[model samples]
Target: MRWTAFLCRLAVGGIFVYACLDKIQHPQAFAVDIHNYRLVPWALLHPWAHYLPVLEATAGLALVLGVARRGAALVLGGLTVVFIVAIAMALLRGLDISCGCFDTDGGHGVGLDLLLRDLVLLLACLPPLLVRDSGPALEQLWRGRP
Candidate 1:
């Protein structure tokens, strides 16, 4: 279970860091992708696009490094929840927008597929939060020394 949590952290954190870095490399295109979603108001879109990657990268790094691991996982789990909601809303509204998740090369877009994938990732993250204290090394859930 500890190993599972670690692997999950690695998978999710690496993807987040890579995705954020990819967007950081192409802010203009990412901003355009955000614009296409039409969820962010025009005034907020630019600022969000500019700053979101930094937060994502920071959180991702924190998760991957196991620095404040529980806190980082909680934050990222919350973010995944928000992302799921936003993606669901976009898909239901039939909005045509790039998913802008991992693949920033060009062919990214939001749809049922993206939502399902994010949902799976989100579910994958839940066990680390749910089944408390079984893992020997997790101080947050366990009662003993780390």
Candidate 2:
């Protein structure tokens, strides 16, 4: 169980790190991408686009390192839920846009693909929250460690 949790953290955290790096490497392009989403109001878009990558990278690093792991996981998980809601709202409104999530360049538009990807990732976010509190009991049962 511990190993599984570790692997899950690594997977989720690694993707977040990659996402942040992608945005940081191209904040201007990323800003354009965020604008394309039409999700953020025009006025708020610039600040969000500029700052989100930093948050994602910092939180992701913390999750991967097990440093303030619970807090990091909580924030990351909450963000994932927000993404899910945004995607769902986009689809509901019939607005075509790019997910801009780990996007390839700035060409792609948000679609069922992005929606499904986020949905799957949301599943990954759950185990950490669900099992984190109960982990010690399982560890003791397995006699893995103190």
Candidate 3:
């Protein structure tokens, strides 16, 4: 069970880290992708696009490093839920938008495919959320004063 939690952290963390790299490098494209969603107001598009990647990267790094497992899991888990909602709504409304999971110039858009993928990732978050003592978290192993 603890091993499961560790695996969950790695899977989800790796995803967020992977997802943010492109967006962080290509803020303008990400801004356009956010605009395509038409959910956030225009004024917020640039800022949200710019800062979200930072948040995603930070929390993801924390999870992977096992420095703050519970807090990072909560944040990344909540983010997964948000992504699921956005993807589902985009599919339901038939809006043509980048899913924004990985890249801004997307081959992957919000649809049944991406929605299902996000749902599976969300499920992965559960073990870390529920299991307090995840196996061999690096922070625990370090035994250094945090």
Candidate 4:
């Protein structure tokens, strides 16, 4: 169970970190991607673009490093839900747009496959959130555990 949680943390955290990298580097491009979703208000688009990636990166690093793992899991899980909603809304509205998951530009289009992937990632957030002790984490080392 502990090992499972640890692995889940690594997978979820690593994914978020990877997903945010391009966005952090190119906020303008990310804002365009967010614009394609048509969900965020025009007034809030730029601020969302500027901060969302940083938030993802911060939570992701916390999870990966085993500091505040549960908190990070909660945050990432919430973000995944938002992603799912955005993708679903886009599909329902018949708008074709890149997911902006891993890349801010020229990424894969939003579809059932992407939705399913986010669902799976959402599920993956559970273990670390539920399990109290994830094995071999930095938290354990910090507390002087072997």
Candidate 5:
């Protein structure tokens, strides 16, 4: 169980960190991607693009480092839910746009596949959230636990 939680943390955290890299480097392009979704308001596009990546990176780091793993899982899980909703809305509305997931430029189009992927990522967040003790976490090391 401990190993499961640890592995789940690594998987979700690594994905989030990787996903944010392109966005962090290309905020303007990311803003355009978010605009393509049409879910965010015009006024909030820049801010969302700028800050969301940072948030993802922070949470991902915390999860990977085993510091505040549960909180990080919760945050990443919530973000996954939001992504799923955005993708579902895009499909239902018949909008053809890039997912803006891992990359802001030429990303794959929104589709059921992306939605399912996010669902799986959301599921991956569960163990860290539910498990009381994360295996070999930085938190334990910091507290001098063997």
Candidate 6:
């Protein structure tokens, strides 16, 4: 169970890290991607686009490093839910928009496939939250003896 939890942290954390890199590098394109989602109003779009990647990357780093693991799990889990809802809504409305998830500007289209992946990832986010200890954390080391 400990190894499992650790793997989950790595996988979930890795995903967020991978997802944010492109967005951070191409924020303008990410902004455009967010715009296509149409979830945010014009005024809020730029800020959301700019800040979201930072948030994702931070949470990812925390998870991967096992620092504040549970909190990071919770945050990433919330993000997964939001992504699921947004992708589902986009598909339902026939919006034909890109998911802008892992790739903000590589033209990754929103579809059932992406929705399924996120749904699975959301499930992945759960065990870490429910399990005690949540694997080895940097917090553990900090409290240990030299």
TM-score of each: 0.82, 0.80, 0.92, 0.95, 0.96, 0.93
Q: What is the lDDT of residue 82 in candidate 1?
A: 77
Q: Residue by residue across 27-146, what tens digits does model 6's lDDT show?
A: 898998888777889889888888899999999999988887889999999999988888888888899877788776556788888988998898888877777666777877886521
Worst 10 residues of 2 by lDDT: 133-142
Q: Give the per-residue lDDT digits (tens) of candidate 1, residues 31-121.
A: 8777777778988998998888887898778777656666666777887887888888888898877788764566667778777888887
List lDDT for all candidates, in order. Answer: 0.74, 0.73, 0.84, 0.92, 0.92, 0.85
Candidate 4 stretches greater than 4 Å from native: 141-146
For residues 1-146, what per-residue lDDT tens digits would candidate 2 score against the true structure?
A: 66666666677878899888878878778888777657789888878887888888987887776665667778888888887887788788887767778863855566777768877776776665555542333234455442
Q: After superposition, how far is residue 38 of candidate 1 from its true place, in Å?
A: 1.0
lDDT of 6: 0.85
Q: Where is model 6 poorest over a 10-residue stretch in terms of lDDT? A: 137-146
Model 1 scores what on Cα lDDT? 0.74
Which residue segments of model 6 deviate by more than 4 Å? Answer: 144-146
Candidate 3: 10-residue stretch with minimal lDDT:
137-146
Instruction: Look at candidate 1 and give me any clashing residue pairs.
Output: 99-109
Name every residue pair that clashes in candidate 6: none
In angstroms, give how far residue 126 of model 4 lies from its true place. Answer: 0.4
What local lDDT does model 2 show for residue 146? 29
Worst 10 residues of 5 by lDDT: 137-146
Which lDDT value does model 1 have at 135?
40
Top TM-score prediction, candidate number:
5
Worst 10-residue lDDT window, candidate 1: 131-140
Clashing pairs in 3: none
Query: Please, what's the RMSD in Å of model 1?
Result: 3.4
